[model samples]
Target: MIALVDMNSYFASIEQLDRPEWRGRPLGVTNGRTGTCIITASYEARACGIRTGMRVREARALAPDFIQVPARPYRYAQVSSSIMAALESITPDIEIFSVDEAFLDLTACQKLYRCPVEVVARKIKHCVFEASGLLCSVGVSGDKTTAKWAAKQQKPNGLTIVEPWRVAERLAPVPVTELCGISTGIGRFLAQHGVYLCGDMKQIPISVLAGRFGNLGRRIWLMAQGLDPEPLHREVKAPKTIGHGKVMPPDTRDRQEVDRYLMHMCEKVATRLRRHQLQAGVFSIGLNTRRGWVARKLKTVHPTADSDPLIALARFFLENWWDGVGVHQVHVAALDPHPQACQGELFAPDHARRDRVLAVMDAVNQRYGEFALCRAPLVKRSDMPNVIAPSWKPAGYRNTLEP
Candidate 1:
């Protein structure tokens, strides 16, 4: 059996757990800007119609007495690490889907416990609560997709089981969007073709679905049948790309200020790449504007993990892409890890010298602090957002206690 566990309003729940006054209050966690969206909302805030990705102004308009707190990625990660450790005690077969969600191969754990699946599920929840003072919803099924879908049926603290026989009955009425890999666009496409509910999918011919979506169509069909042949991945897949972005204060479009944020983000991305012992062959810079968003990507002949080159590329892309649009955010990403060795030109001996300089800079910053030896543009920038991407690992934290 597979057990999928999801934390309840993770960031806001952590904020409430750490602060006594915030508990049971209508609160939200955000990125420290009034214009930015709330990253997570507590159950109390949800009761007041507050939700994740809702702008602070909109949330305030909905609930005048809403309390907002800045997100602490470090604290959230520390608690996540503890919860994962507790899960590890139950079974070694744990796949961390994200910071707030994980799946376990409960087949082994069930045998070890020699108890009913419901009892084992309850023990897992109690273990997590004892470790981190947080609640998690767990769903158990024979398949990963069904387990995950079942986990979301309840909130705050819930345990739902989809036994092999009841999979279709339990999931049939649910919207197609609730299944994994079903985006809003995909859901719309499916809905237009009369596949709205999970049960409705079995009516579509596999060949027709395959003609439209290839392998993804077949996967969707299987999920609709409440079966997922995909096994629990014992190893966590390495991220294909590493990136970070910050929502700018409303109505601000100064190019120089955007450059500052871009440079800071590049530094962060490079630091993460080097920490993972990875080098990127492609880099991308994105700007979210009032009109729309634009991203420009470039592939390098040589793999590099240095921040200076990335920052320069980002600046180049931004200057060309910006068309007097009111920019609202800055994002930078390192994608497609290069497998080739570093290529150097004979004339540019400074290439190796620059790499050494960056290595030394990284060393100094690792000892002192992030951006301690940052470039000139970022020296006085204290407003640089310290946000964590979904791909963030607790091991990336400076003082992580993870084993």
Candidate 2:
């Protein structure tokens, strides 16, 4: 059995943990003040109709007493580490799915525990709460997808066990989109073909699905039957890309400030690449401007993890592609590293020396804190991007929330 464990309203719950008075209040975590959109909302805020992307002003209108707190990535990371440690106590065969979720293989552990999987799951939940002051929902099923769906059936604290035979019946009324891989686009496509519920998907012929969505259709067919052959990989999969984007405090045409934002983004992206022991073969820059979206990408002959080259590339794109239109957001993305690639040419003069310098900088930053050895222009600033999503992780590490 696979047990998918997830923290409830992670960020907001963390806020309540830090400030006892905030508990049971409609609260949100945001990057900015007053009118900004929220990144996370508490269960209390959800009951008041405040959602993750809703603006603070709108949320306040729904619940006049709504409170918004700025996000603190480090504090959240601290809590996440404790939560993961608690889960690790239950089983070593664990996959960190996200900052707030993980999958633990209990097929073998149940015998060791001398209890059924459900009893073991209850013990895990109590252990997590005792360690982290957080409540989690656990779902036990034969596969990860069904386990995840079962976990989401209840909120704050829930436990659901879906044996193989009960998977289809339990998920019959659930929307197809509730499954992990079904995005809004996929849901719409399925709806067009008269498939709306989880059970409805099983009625479609596998050949028709395969013809429509190619390989993805087969995955969907298996999902409908609550089956996933994939196992919990002890090692997390390598990321296909590393990227970060931040909405400007105020939409502006100020080029210098825009350049600063690009520099900050490059620092973040490059730091992530080095942390993963990977180098980007290509980089891209994007902007959401008043004139609509614009982007440019370039491939590099030498894969590198230095911020200088990435910032220069980003500046080049901004200089050539930007039309002086008001900019709303800035984004930087590093893509497609060869799976076996790492630092190169240990004895090559200039190139190898530069790589060594970057490695030292990364070591310093990781030891003292992020950006401790960053360039002057990329120095820590109150408004600089510091958001760490569920997928963020450093190299040479399996699972973490530090960014």
CA lDDT of every candidate: 0.79, 0.80
Native-vs-model 2 lDDT?
0.80
Among all windows of ten consecutive residues in candidate 1, which has the lowest summed lDDT?
394-403
Candidate 2 residue 323 C-alpha distance from true site, Å: 3.2
Indicate the TM-score of model 1. Answer: 0.86
Q: Which stretches of candidate 1 lie over 4 Å from their true place?
A: 33-36, 249-253, 286-302, 315-325, 339-357, 382-384, 393-403
Query: What is the total number of backbone clashes in candidate 2?
Result: 2
* lDDT per residue (tens digit) for residues 281-393 in model 2: 79888998877779888765567777888888887887788878888888888877544354445653366677788889888988997778877766544353366666743
Residue by residue across 89-172, what tens digits does model 1's lDDT show? Answer: 888898877788888987766656888889988988998899899999999998989999889888769999889888988889
Task: Point out the worst 10-residue segment of candidate 2 by lDDT.
Answer: 394-403
